[model samples]
Target: MLQHWLLGSLALQNIGRRKARASLLIAAVAISSAIVFTGVVMMRSIETSMAVGFSRLGADLMVVPQNALTNITAALLTAEPTGEVLDADLLDQAHITGISRAAPQRVFRTEQSEFGGQGESVDLIGYDPGNDFTIQPWINERLGRPMQPGDVILGAARDVPLGSEIALFGKPFRVYAKLGRTGAGTHERGIFMPSAELLALVPAIREQTRKTPPMLEPRKVSGFLIELTPGATELQVRFALLSHLSGTKVVAGGSLLTGIRQGVTALLGGAISLVSMMFASTALMVSVLFSAIVTERRSELGLLKAIGAKRSQIVGMVLIEAIVATGGGGLCGVVFGMLLLRLFERSLVYYLTEIGVPFLWLDRMDTVLVAAACILGAGLIGAIGALTPAWRSSRHDPYDLIRGEG
Candidate 1:
């Protein structure tokens, strides 16, 4: 134990003696690790953000009347005010397998009624409040009370305050909540209310417009947005829907977005490969530097061996110096990487969110774990790099090393 303590002390002293060179090695390792850490965190964050955005969208599959005119973008966000109608009882009768929850929507345009303003359009979306999964998820602020009849939830663009009253088709309704900006046209500019309330207003809306859309008919709906059960693939659910619900077309966004997910995954794989290559290069650099260090200290090592230092002790001392320097660099790299991420957040991520783009950072625990792994990896790299050179120098004859002949 005493001998080991003395050797450790001597190893630390050797590092102190060559502060300039040691600093250079530490700096090199720090820069490499910092780049790797930052790239991984950002890539993981982007993938996570995409997943969140998809979940909050509330539907993996959208079912509409066969031959009904539809917009692909609207299916991904909120269904547009298509006048096409379907039997509201279809969902109950279908009994499709793999369906966890399905919410019905009745969409109507108030362009003729001039609801918001003259020549301006407002989409009135009637949803089953009990079964709804989409609109509520994006709500930024709302009244604390449960949503009741005669209550209306406005999109993010509407300049309305909660608890205020607004007249729809000449009847007064209370403003219930405002949704967060979703960058979707319907979600940002639509008005949402319960199906029962919207149905009750059909008479008043007909009186104002002199015509009722097909979707406004009794026991009719524009479409149904569906959520699948766990372990159920989109294709499986889609086939089930087609088998049961006749005269309906299923729009599966998962199929459309699969390519995007693959692209992001590919990018992440490439980033990992690049980081691995950089670390490998850093390990090689450490090996060359330590080899030179062992060569230059030949006489010193011979003197220690002549005084009864074991071969293992000589190798351990060299390895200890390498580990300390590389581990310290790894810690500094994590700190610098965090600062870089902060700057990235303030500049790019903030701008994206302001423009209503979705982006979420990795959680704190995962980030810390990644940092720890980087530090451990650096230490292992140090040990591997110093091993061969240290062993080679320790095997030489003491007399030859002292005479500067080997």
Candidate 2:
């Protein structure tokens, strides 16, 4: 009985026989639904890449020269550097906290490259291989050999390939290895070397370089990377360290990431809401078209009712026609949106890479989410468009509709 109501010959005839209405309804939905899905997928892809990059650092707190994170994060995430220097002593002081592991180093921003083809601006990080709190293992990779003072490791974002010779200031050093992708972050844009090697490359650097002149002295270690001891809460240690550091600050990854994500969420929510409003208006237009068509066929409906066809059955027939029209539109929109994303990715990489920002790959998960959203959005809009026609058809009086008389 249910199948007969939904799949009846009459319901099927209504859609195939009406070329103009079906085309209009489908076109309206396809454009609006595609815009909605595309916006959401792009926002999520970039934000998710940033979060993953932060987690990969494996450090609880980042210590940079005062106000350096924005610059540091940009340099690492986006490739732009900012911040003044702090005393290198802070690195030791952070380590003395008895509850943290602190890694300290100097970062020199310059057009330094390995196996030089064209010079690319890179953050050349100089550290004690023996005491790096983060990124040292990736640099000191054992697969080939341990990094010597003259060695360098290109980050995944580095344009140079592995085992290439990179020269800075006329001093050519071997590229020991490449670090794994930190997903569109700074490590990818940097060249890591021992502090001794960095000093040897520059003449103005070797003199008065007490414990080494940081890329900017008195600014010493730009900041310390802090890892709390096991079983200890990050917030608990953060407060203690801040109290001790006084002029210096300790910020947690959670605080930074949360702020950025919230800002993005608000922005995306605003955009989607606007698009939804537009979709609502378009759906109403579809409603009007279907409503008129049903009214024009009122005599046919009345005749069916008189012939013992239920009002409910007639209403279902109108709704099914609307659903079929919108569903096909939804599928086409999803496919078109995905193809557009792929076409634009190459162009996007140029701008992102130029600024030292990480690349966010639009993978299978993103595709699935986008497709589901398109399908669901069409179903909801189709249901709304069908409502008026379904109600009007069901309410007609057979005598008024058929006899051409009230």
Candidate 3:
């Protein structure tokens, strides 16, 4: 026990003596660990956000005009503008089996200048409040009251303040509530209101454009939001809709966000590959650094052996020094990584949005796990790096090393 204590003290003293070199090694490990931590946390966040957003959407399928399928999908997923209109009477003509509820929506694009510097055009969704199950729950949770004629609800990403009146088509509408971040689809950038109010605004819009009145005629809808009954599958409802509805395309909810999911998956793959490369490079650096340190301290190790120190003790001492350096650095890395993620979160989201990918930051539990994994991984790397150096030093001939020939 005394010998072990002496060996530990010697190792610590040696680390203190080479403080600058030790700090460099620690920094290298810390940087690598930080990259890994951030990548894992961000990827997990994206997945979780998608799951939550999809759950909240609460739709089993979407039915759109056959020619407007691509445009409608883009509008719903990426907030892109759509010009397609469908006959609202299609709801009466098509009755899908196992469908418990359906809501029709009229989609339009707000003028670019009306966004108050948002840079991107906002999608305006007009829904029948009485028939809507999709947005009603969110509205109830957020506003606690039914939507009035002039009320508008903004999506998660809108910077508009609650109760502020925003002008659209020469008329002002009050912002009733702002939706929570959904992180997956167009709800993050949409403005929802009752279809009657949206239809009423069409005249003003036409007057502003100097076109003939009634550009958006009454009873014209863009798409249908569908909900299935209990024990009914989306596939079953989809087939029924396709069989009953003519000139319309029915898409399952799971298939709606395929493009965005693919993009996120690609981004995650690239991030993982980059992090793996960083880990490999960091491990190689640690190995090279410790090997040099071992070569430089050959005489010291030899002196300890001559004084009856066991080979295992020498190996343990080297490993302890490496671990101590890396462990401290790993903790710092975790902190740095979290800070980096927070600082760049908005920018990251914007970039992903531009590329049409979904992005989300990790929640508390995920962040903690990422930090722990990074710190532990750093320690493991340090131990592995020290192995070769420790073994070489332990096997050295004490006589030759002492005479400066080892």
The model with the greatest TM-score is: 1
RMSD (CA, angstroms), candidate 2: 12.5
Output the lDDT of residue 260, model 2. Answer: 49
TM-score against truth, every candidate: 0.57, 0.51, 0.52
What digit string (tens of lDDT, one per residue) describes model 1 on residues 98-147? 77778889988777544567757888888887878778777789999988
Model 2, backbone clash pairs (residues 3+ apart or across chains), number: 14
Span of ten consecutive residues with least summed lDDT in model 1: 254-263
Q: Write candidate 2's Cα lDDT for 188-256 as tens digits.
A: 777777766765665633432223334545336566666555445667777777766766666565544
Best by lDDT: 1
**Model 2 worst lDDT window (10 residues):** 71-80
| Of 1 and 3, the candidate ranking higher by TM-score | 1
What lDDT does candidate 3 reach at residue 155? 83
Clashes of each: 0, 14, 0
Cα lDDT listed for each candidate: 0.83, 0.63, 0.72
* lDDT-superior candidate, 1 or 3: 1
Candidate 2 local Cα displacement, residue 152, angstroms: 22
Error of 1 at 74 (Å): 2.3
